[model samples]
Target: MRTVGNDLVRHQLHENRKWYLLLGALLIIFGVVLLASLGMATLSVVFLFGILMMVGGVLHIVAAFKIFDGGYRWLWAIFGVLYLIAGYYAFTAPVQTAVVLTSLLAIALIIGGIIRIINAFMFKPLPGWGWTLFSGLLTLLTGILIIASPTSPFWVLGMFLGIDILFQGINYLTLAAAIRNIPPSSADV
Candidate 1:
């Protein structure tokens, strides 16, 4: 009446259970630390983002010269220069960078939410369209709230980061538990 598939996958997951547990524990610890030092952690995250942008810019510049042959190389170079300047400013003034980035994030969320809402309506014939619409509405509300309280970026960014980390840790833990609980058939290794 029913079929079971991929015994080897089950065995592998069982074998790797310890690693999953370890990862979950590590994430939970990091989440706790993030929550404890919310402001400092937020600042650190912003600075790290700046560093990543610089690295991305460098890579883009390199790719423009080495990877691309003709058309968009100059455009890539210009983008690289802009990224470098933005990264330098972010590193030099992390607090200000965080504020500016927060505003950008708000704008992005609003635009993305609007797009999602429109797409949901376009795809109304598909299953789970309501969920998509709900998610878009939630995103829209969150963006609006963030924009309304423009001055609370410091706390908002910090608290959201910590909460996200905590949820990630919980997700890992749940995944490990689910893997452990999976029933193996006779074909299992």
Candidate 2:
């Protein structure tokens, strides 16, 4: 059994986790809102989000540099480089990102629907399968529509932003909530 001191340390560790989770939650919210607003407007939201990502990516690179003395410095540098590349892409092609986001959403929905249908079939339930099946079918139909007209710039951008923003908001909220629930660390003492 751990001593009381260890318990306190554990609790402190939990608190740190809570803080990181809160940060992640914020990121998710930002992504969703940025995407949604992009849908509502046009290039403004996309630019804003891209700029944000770029700034964050640059900061990450600098941090990685600081850890050069560590064993995994190369790995960190690689990650930093990858983020930089992504940031550059986001900055250069916000519009394309908007369209891509829409495509991704449709594909995700279709996959999710298929998975749900499969799950429903897996469980031998004689009742309450109607709703599941209906939802799955609807998702599949939406997916088909997305695939049928990937070139519709307006629809794709609008939906992409809106859906991205909403989902990101929800993601942030969830992460924040999870962080808030972690037990306090003993280190507080």
Q: TM-score per candidate, in order? A: 0.79, 0.53
Candidate 2 segments whose C-alpha is farther than 4 A from its true place: 1-45, 66-71, 124-126, 160-189
Query: What is the alpha-carbon lDDT of model 2 when measured against the actual structure?
Result: 0.66
Tens-place lDDT per residue, model 2, 74-142, is 677677677777667766887687666666777888898897787667663768777787788888887
lDDT of 2 at 26: 68
lDDT tens string, model 1, 22-110?
A: 88888889888988987877787788788988998898899889887777998898888888888899889988988887787788889
With a 3 Å backbone cut-off (N, CA, C), the pairs that clash in candidate 2 are 8-186, 11-184, 11-185, 11-186, 12-185, 12-186, 32-165, 35-161, 36-161
List the RMSD of every prediction in angstroms: 3.9, 8.7
Question: Model 1 has how many clashing residue pairs?
Answer: 0
- Ten contiguous residues minimizing lDDT sum, candidate 2: 36-45
